[model samples]
Target: MKRRKRKRYVSTDIRKSENGATFLSILITFVIVMITLPLLVYLLTYVQPVKHNNELSVNQFFIFLRNDVLTSEQVYTDDDNKMYFLLPTDEVAHIEQYQNVIRRQVNGRGHEIYLRDIDSFTLQPISFGTQVTIVTKEGREYEKKIAHYE
Candidate 1:
């Protein structure tokens, strides 16, 4: 009887394929994460953050003053009825009071009650506040939320 020759089988390179897939997956995920991080941070800050001076209400200002932040100075009200409260530092407090104000060129305009004076404010770091400035579709400026010092 004649004997048949044995056949040999060759192994496939499966490791290369697996490594390529792993690398690709990791790269794609990293890119996606990096892109989303900044957007998320921007949204959070835009929705809320610390200190908004552009537009503040009298009630809000009063709240800060009541906290013993503003001394007898660092405040001014313009002649046209614009109230200016500037706390330069621990040493300089400027206060002013005015009335019948129109639009203040220096600080912009709304109503007119200028209160101006110079005094000293105690320098104490209270809790921080978050300010949000967002532009509306109609081109109006609105304060979203008043963050309190907690």
Candidate 2:
């Protein structure tokens, strides 16, 4: 009877080298990560925050304006393009562009800044309400139509 010989499989040196990541591959991966990390951090920390803050501020301004208009007894824009809201308590809220900022005055007193870095602010009387358009110094345009309660 002939006996069958079992063949032993041995891993070569080349096979061992290819089994895991080499020094060159690890170094290249580290270099790629180092190159991309700073750019990602810069975009997340610097580039996005400024624009995001600007937009957030503008939105908050709009919300405040809308709330003031909706809760007021009357809303009107004067010949000088300044907006006025007559509240239920007989208090007048005046909103106008003062230099490079939009300010709010209560009964023609106090300086309350609503928005800053403004290039232009316009209030156009629409059929249903007023269309407020603001142009920022950075060339950004934002418009919102706030409706009157009555």
Candidate 3:
């Protein structure tokens, strides 16, 4: 009986194949980064948050005041730029401009800011209620005539 020897087949080097795959992956990652970097930078540089100004604040203040006045039992103004509200709950709410900000106080106690960046605030007595005017530090003027029911 004769024994036959089997021939060994050598495979390709693993390192050579791995090096090509690593280089291809690196190139793909670099291309993706390069394409996205400019877009990201543009978004960061051009996209901005909505700016808030005294005009918007004043408008919001007027909206709140109108709602309060509509619900209040009585609305009146003092000698200065101050308005008072007699709530149904019998609590007094005072609205006034202190320094450069308009604030509200309940029962003459807590200090809550309503509007800011004020240059001047005026309350003119009208027939039914008062005419409110506000001048911002930026020289913008806002005026509203709020009337009370009953």
Candidate 4:
């Protein structure tokens, strides 16, 4: 019987040198930081509570205006710093007197009042609560409760 000698196995090197590995790690880290920096800045600046008021106001304005019950004629900010919603009405007598400003009249129950001559309204953030009011062309007013934004 002839005996055969076994060959020694050697491990092949797949990894780069220590310095090259360190450089590659640093490059990867820098790329990740650059990609995330702008997103972080944007979220910190634009998506903060500091913009809550403006965001709520703009959303409220659009929502109330788009109600199907009301017809929008004109939307303008008045000298009194109040935003006004202009509406047209001919159903009720003396409604023409309040062509621009909304008119309120006490109901028969006296607990609530009806309003007319308003196109739409936004609920300004008030300490009391979130209240939305709207008016139709037929001189009808509708009020609704809304969720308040923090």
Of the two candidates 2 and 4, the one with more favorable TM-score, higher being better, is: 2
Provide the lDDT at 135 for model 1.
32
Runs off by more than 4 Å, candidate 1: 1-21, 49-150
Q: Write candidate 4's Cα lDDT for 100-120 as tens digits.
A: 443322221122112333455
Clashing residue pairs found in predicted model 2: none
Candidate 2 residue runs with Cα over 4 Å from true position: 1-50
Of candidate 2, the 10-residue stretch with the lowest lDDT total is 9-18
Taken over the whole model, the C-alpha lDDT of each candidate is 0.39, 0.89, 0.89, 0.44
Backbone clashes counted, model 1 = 40
TM-scores, each model vs. reference: 0.21, 0.69, 0.65, 0.21
Q: Model 3 Cα displacement at 38 (Å)?
A: 10
The residue-by-residue lDDT of candidate 2 on 114-143, one tens digit each, is 999999999998999999999988888999
Best model number under TM-score: 2
Q: What is the lDDT of candidate 3?
A: 0.89
* Candidate 4, residue 141: lDDT: 55
Which sequence of candidate numbers ranks them by TM-score, best first? Answer: 2, 3, 4, 1
* Model 1 vs. true fold: TM: 0.21
